[model samples]
Target chain A: MKRGIAGSLESNDALITVKESDKLEITIKSVVYDFFHKQIEKTIRDTLSELGIDKISVVCEDKGALDFTVRARLITAVKRMEASK
Target chain B: MRRSLLFIPGNNPAMLRNSDVFESDAVIYDLEDAVSVTEKDAARELVSGFLNCAGALPMEVIVRINGLDTEYFSADLEAVVSDKIDSVMLPKASAAYLAELDFLLTEQEKKKGLKKRINVVPIVELASSVLQIDEIVKCPRVNGVLLGAEDLSGDIEVMRTKKGNEILYPRMKLAYACAAYKIDAIDTPFTDVNDGAGLEEDCRFVANLGFNAKAAIHPNQVPVINSIFVPAQKSIEWALRVQEAARQASLKGLGVFSLDGKMVDKPVILRAENIIKKARKYNLI
Candidate 1:
């Protein structure tokens, strides 16, 4: 069974959805997409690497959140997915 | 010199980012009461990362971690014991916990290669902590005591009041203990954010009761609290006069002298000097 989605969707925040997958896939939808798309993607990848998480599909919807906030939401989502295991 | 210590929820990144804008004397990144249990780890990581990367904020940065007995305490300490933090606010503090935390902090400082010692301010919330205020304040790494009125009221089975009559005794006891130890005594946050009038009144009351600072929960409360706690113009003038008189007396080889017909001794001179120092800090002189 797939783990449930988690994280916040508040303003200046991000909502992260994590699900079990055969291979790792990361997607991002951000309000400041044109300006910070690459940086956001790098932050998500870096956070996942630090946590040693793979084989999971991650979706992040950002609303102008900073790198720390993005990393925090991703970590929380991963923890939630792990807890449901 | 902590006129105001504002509590920012650790889980809220936006608040943490905008914390310095409030210009509070200290900003407490709270991992204790503000964060939910499930989000504790994420909050700790976010706070630590932000502190490490954030360069030279205008205010002091403090982290309120879980109590020593909690399962999350060790992890919280591990995440937060960095050079970026000015102090650790220990919730539900007691003498025993303070001693243990002192040891833990030393170990963390050494392992992290932190050049300066991180100070600890104990929050007196439980009835047991209030009773042991003297011992708690005397702990080596202790820098101050902060009153936690909401938790304390719950512990004592008393209703918290806007006038704060129920907590008077405990507040006085904690304040006196801090004064005896020459450490800071911080009053609890006024929970009614909408009632600016009531908050101002409470700040004045606590300031009169010898509290050196008050914790604020909102940005709007910061300026009001800071203004109330700063020495008044008349008081600053009086302090300057007393300071000059004491200087003259000392030069004349006199330890005691009369100022406005009141005997000025060591304690009086010390109080005057403190007032003047505070005035200088606030740019009043």
Candidate 2:
């Protein structure tokens, strides 16, 4: 029911998109997939869970964003989605 | 000795990451006017998380939250209150607002078990607050006062000019009140970011008017503001000589001394000591 995009494609940032869905689904694309892949996924999941969001689809294109930046982009995308609805 | 306080938007990660590199005396992570209504929560979370992770920042970290009149005030405080923050910049500040903020900050400190008390710096932006400047600075947790020229000018129905003719009275009132209270008086930012000459002139004018520091909307203005507020090399040398002479006089059981054939009193000695202290703090000595 809701869809939004937050963040930029610039370095040290993450381009995130969120859409309403029946169940949680996440897809991440990043250059540092080998070393930081799990950490990045956990950050996204933790942020969504903190916001009381469970049914959503997220696509994160990361450019070496830290945990805080990832959380910020994800929360922004979720807020945008909620507002759209 | 805050020569410059740079304002960084809370929602922008790039800006926040690069904040520590600017070398400003203080960096204000702005969550009030800079952050939109919808992204308030996101910005708060980001700032809180970033502060929590930042081990030891080179400069002071101040968080500027929304005013007490807004619903976001409580949440903003909750999100940003932490041991990492050196101070909280309260926008549109007044006596009542500062009192409430002091109470809330105390509660937050207790809740978080913070070892040190966080200071609150008031921003006098409204005409009503400007009228209550004396009372506002007298609040419990206020360590400094910053003039918000844009909002103050708007409130008084005057256009903000680069010449800064309209807001002179309010600026002077705030500076005088802060001086009486022995607190820092910070001037507003020069809005035109591209005008280097104008920024230098404005900084000199405010610094000469007894302002302790000036705010910067951009990082590039930080160096200019710092240079203008810092004591000149010749003045530093003069202060050093005066201090040394005073020390020798004190050892000789004298309350006054002659420096460069001019009578130097206790007040003059104190001024020289203060100048040297500022110079040392800024690494100019």
Best by DockQ: 1
Complex DockQ per candidate:
0.57, 0.52
Docking verdict class for candidate 1: medium
State the weakest 10-residue window (summed lDDT) of model 1 chain B. Answer: B45-54
For residues B83-113, could you state the per-residue lDDT of candidate 2 as single tens digits?
A: 8999999999989989999999999999999
Clash list (residue pairs), candidate 2:
none
**Which residue ranges in model 2 land beyond 4 Å of their true spot?**
A2-11, A20-23, A31-39, A46-55, A76-85
DockQ computed for model 2 against the true two-chain complex using alpha carbons: 0.52
Clashing pairs in 1: none
lDDT of 1 at B99: 89
How do all models score by TM-score? 0.94, 0.92
DockQ, computed on Cα atoms, for candidate 1: 0.57
